[model samples]
Target: MAHRSFLPSARAANVIIALGAFALGWAIYVRYALLEQSSVGLACRTLETLTCETRATVIALFSQSAFGIAALIGAILQLIRPSLIMFTLALMATCAGLVVYNNNLAGLAGGLLLISFARPWRGARG
Candidate 1:
């Protein structure tokens, strides 16, 4: 068997890459007004309620998508790269999922499962 450590360390690199990707995704949605209008003005009475609900909707959408993507990527990366990078990516995705998914329990569960299992990098003790 090949001896390679996927331990979650080296503190890694390419985080900015992932961040940039996320930023790009957000920007694209904003620029294009792509997020559906279902949540907007769902309740016009009381400015505070409308604002809160709008924000919540956006967050829910973002989180749900983030979680699904993370799970998918984590699975693929587990087979493709070092564990550290995969773990880092999985962690980021989990955060996004936890923040945005409406049914947060499901999102959090999926994201955590991915993070918990990413292989450890070399010398990545703990």
Candidate 2:
């Protein structure tokens, strides 16, 4: 009999990755909505209900979503490979996301996951 590792299975890892991507996507969408609303200026007046307070709410939502996605992607990638490069990329993406809307997280996580899962790199030498 062989000893089995306790880490999450591939299916579980994929699910976590998908969730992180969704959070990132949602955050980007919220930011886009806020920007579009602000740029149009008087468009809010036509609605009669939109207000400055909503912008603050959207900003807060973006922050939380960004944090969740970053943390999830970072944690999951570390679990999958324990690579410093991957972790650094995740951290950078998360930090950059705070200042601007970017789709880097999805690409980074997706690429890392694909590479990590497509072939086992554990204990391989450069």
Candidate 3:
């Protein structure tokens, strides 16, 4: 039998890295554009424009830690049954949640995702 590698394939790793980077970039944009205490945020609060509306919607979504909850759930699922899709979801949500004022749960989820890296493949035998 061929030896099973501990880590994912290089292509998978590349996809994960690229997607994670994109997620982080998008999260950073959201944090600065719609959530920070800058002139943009001030305009979002004071004006009645499309950008402000979008900002309000984003704020509403994160108000009750929706992103954090999603990340936590996704991470839990990923830990139970590791897969690229679940990993990607958890990773993206963790990045967004952490940047969008949902650090508590997001941090926990990130820890779980890290732990999941040690989990064996679904069909791997001892």
Candidate 3 local Cα displacement, residue 6, angstroms: 6.8
Q: Residues 1-126, candidate 1: write the lDDT tens digits.
A: 344444433234466356636844653453234234454435433456645565656656555565556545664665454465455555555444444442354354454445444544454444
lDDT of 2 by residue, 1-126 (tens): 342333345565566566546656655655666555665346654554454456555556555666436644774776576554554455445543543443455445545544444434443333
Output the lDDT of residue 124, model 3: 40
Clashes of 1: 10
Task: Show model 3 residue runs off by greater than 4 Å.
Answer: 1-6, 45-50, 123-126
Give stretches of model 1 more than 4 Å off: 10-60, 63-66, 102-126
Looking at model 2, the pairs that clash are: none
Higher-TM-score candidate among 1 and 3?
Answer: 3
Q: Candidate 2, residue 117: CA error in Å?
A: 13
Q: Which candidate is the best by lDDT?
A: 3
Alpha-carbon RMSD, each predicted model: 8.7, 8.3, 3.1
In the range 2-41, model 3's lDDT, one tens digit per residue, is 4332356778779988898898898888778666857887
